[model samples]
Structure formats: structure tokens, C-alpha cells
Target: MGGSGLLGLEVTRQARRAGQRVATTFHTRRPDGDAHHLDIRDRAAVIALVRAVEPAVVVNAAYLQADWATTADGGTHVALAAAATGARLVHVSSDAVFSGAAGRYDETAVPDPITPYGAAKAAAETAVKAITPAAVIARTSLIIGRGDSQHERQVHALAGGAPGALFTDDLRCPVDVGDLAAALLELASSPHAGVHHVAGAGAVSRHELGVLIARRDGLDESALPRALRAGSGLPGPADVRLDNTKTQALLTTRLRGAREFLASPLPVE
Candidate 1:
């Protein structure tokens, strides 16, 4: 694995608990438990890491969208690593890959991204598929769960009295971190290989989700401003909600709805 972000860390921890031999890399924040430092951008280093670990399956949560690039080149690093090692690769992706002009999207839809980040991710997906047809690409939406993910951070900020306007028009499917991790693990282990949508069951706007969080935590929803619709500032789809019918049928685990996904237990192991 590369880039030990929240998703990476969660998947790593799950794999470890399941008694799978797990080896991962870290760039900036070296995880306290056990992690090495390997920059995916360095192709030689990626190849070296793969050879050393000799993993049968590799789940790449390493992303560089917010920084180096978002889409095409961003995912190339991990794809190359998987090819070099002959490991089945599971590349986590995002709903942002679509323009958002069209609300819900499926694996078959042509990627038309409006943001640099989305375009980069789309590029990465393309590269991964070109090299390794069997490489799995899982696109999802606003993922929520432990360790200060965007969603958790927002909640924390709210709890700490941070004031901001939540956009009701901004829609997404926010899957819990744990549930997403489980789904990814299943994909890695199974024979299913292709682009999939691994996210929560239902769709919601940011403002609506904020209200749900507030209600769950007993926070004051009235304090929050009414939701508002906003544009991408670029030509693109609006909803871009993913259809997970394929994922639901293929994987043993069932992705939950947002509410149920949130109400579920946190990692205890």
C-alpha cells in the first residue's frame, strides 16, 4: 500500500487483524504501529517495495490529487507498482471523477471531469486499466469514519463551535470508513476485477448530511444556515451519484445506507 491516509490506515489495520501479511508505506506521517516510507511517485521505489513484500494483492489508497495532481498521473504510480510486482491491484477512486453535470454515474459512463483533481483521477483510472485489465478501480463518494477524515473533522469542528454554511445542493454518498475498508478487502480477495462503485447506499446533500450528523450528536441544527445549491464553476454533471448494483451483487458484504452505515460500530479491534 502507499500513502497511509485514513482509508489506507483503516484497510491496513483490518488486513492485519484478519491475519493477512500487511506491509505499507508512509510519506509524511509515519504511523506509530508499523509502517515504512516509500513515495509512490518514485517508480523505482514502488517496484522495489512490491518485490520486497511479494504481496498477492495490493490495495492502493495512495492519492496525490489535492497536491501533485488529482486524476490521471496521480494513480499511475500505484498502477505501475502493481504491474511490476504482478499483484492484483485495488485502486480506490472518487465520485469526483465525473463532472457532476449528470447526477448518478456508473462504470460505463465516460469520465468528464470539471476539476483538476477529478481529471487527474480519471487519468489514473485510465492508466491502471490500460496496464492491468484485472486491476480493480473502486470509485466512491464522501467517505466518513475514524481518525479525522473530512467528515469526522467537520463534525469535530462543529462540536468545537466552528461556524460555517453547509451546501444543501452538494450531494454525495458518505460511506463509513470501516464499511468501506471491509468492502475493499473483499474486492482484493475475490476474483471480481473491474471498476466498481464502493460507497454508501443512498444519496444526500452536504447540508442534509450535516443535519443528520447534528441530529445524531444532538447538536443544534438551527444554528446551521439553510442549505444552498452551488455550481462546479466548470461544465460537468451535477448528481454524479454512483450506482453500486454491481458491487452489491459481487461482494459478500453489503454496503449500508448512510444512516445505517453511520449508526454501525466503530473499529474495536
Candidate 2:
């Protein structure tokens, strides 16, 4: 639903390019062009919007890391609305659902969240599954954009003498935003149901990812500071990698790794 965010914006752009009649939802900041202002926290509003749109498929990309009502309860509200309208649902999820205890997770791995955000995401996944059994609960890891993603921005800021250091021990499989959006769209139109792991091909530490980003953007990679997340008392997972081998087999779209995608500079706008 979040048509203004990076991944959501890419999804909307790709869908429009494919000649699909898309209706997007926004929360605080409205997206450019036409969009429905939807506060998914309100169940009745969610239902009303879904009914009004009468969409053939619904891709809910809206979420808040800190708000339980929005991430968990809001997801349920969306699911209930989508189920009632019989719309094919592709609910975007996060790898934060995992505790990183298992190191790697497939579609079958049960969520063991240690943080509030992770717990909320897990709860959302559970509710979406129970409400809409046919819905695709696509769980993903760190989403990396060419130059506009938060990670990229942080790297830029750090290189420019920002205080924070990218964690060297905090590992993730960062997927390209374009590839992830394409995969989500593919699953929306496909017959796949249940949980799916849609992530990049390889795993890299957050620091390494930042270095790649630095190089891609012509920054001094050494200028980016690094630290271990283990002793830093970060309340999140350390090495959660989504096993996308199974999901990759089912889709034609190739999910490129960060090393591959960030190897060369993107064309300047």
C-alpha cells in the first residue's frame, strides 16, 4: 500500500509500466499523482478503501517499525479487507521476524523475534496466513536502492563525517529494490501461495554493504567507520539471511546480490 516509500514507489512504477491500473495508499506524506489516503490502523477505513478500489490484486507494502497497531494490527485489518473483497493479496513482510539464531531461514522457518518490531512482524505474518490462506506472505531482508535508500544515505552521511558507524558484524542479504519489486509483482500474478523468501543471492555485513555503496557512489570507502554489533547491544538480529533458493526457482526474475549490483556506479540523473 505504501506508494511513497522506496520499494513501494518502485513497485508502483513497475506496475504502471506493465499497463496495470494501480491504486496506491499513503499514510502521512501523500505520494505524487493520484493516491488514496488510507490509515490502515482503522479497520473500517481499510475495508472501505478496498471495497471502493475493488482491485484484482492487493500489494500491502505499508509498515511501521515502532508502531504495533500499524505493523501487526494494521496488517490484520488489510488482510481482513482483502479477504472480504476476494482480492489476491501479496503482503510484504520482513526478516526481522527471525531472531538470527538459526543464521539462515527458509520459507518454513518459524519466527522467533526478540525485538518488538520483529514480534509485530511475526504477528502480522500469522494473522495474514490465518485470515487469507491463499495470500503470499513475502518475507524479505534489507532492501537496497541504487542511491536513494536509507542505507545509501547513511553511508553518504558517514563518509561526510557523521558519528555513527556501520556495524561490521550485523549481516544481511540486501536485495536490490528493483529486483525485489519485480519479484513481488511476479508472485502477485503467479499461483504461488503461503510464505516465500524473497531476498538477494548472497549475504554481506552491514559495514561491507556500506563499503560497496561508498565505492559505487565514488566515496572514500575507508572513510566509513565500522564497529561490531555483537557488543554494541543492538536489540536486533546479527546474521539473518533469507534462503531464496526455493523462491528463485519459481520466478524468472533474478535477485542480484549487493556485491553484484553495487559493483559499478549507477548513471547519474
Per-model TM against the reference: 0.91, 0.98
For 1-269, candidate 1 gives per-residue lDDT tens digits of 65478888888889889998787788888875667787667777778778888889888887766765433554687778788889999999888888877787777888888877787788888898898889889998887764367875686576567876667677788887788899999999888887999988988877777667766656687766654555535343447688888788887878887777555444555
Candidate 2: the clashing residue pairs are 1-61
Q: In lDDT terms, which candidate is top?
A: 2
Locate the minimum summed-lDDT window of 10 residues in model 2: 25-34
Model 1, residue 162: what's the lDDT?
80
Give the per-residue lDDT digits (tens) of candidate 2, residues 34-109: 6999898999999999999899999999999989999999999999999999999999999999999999899999
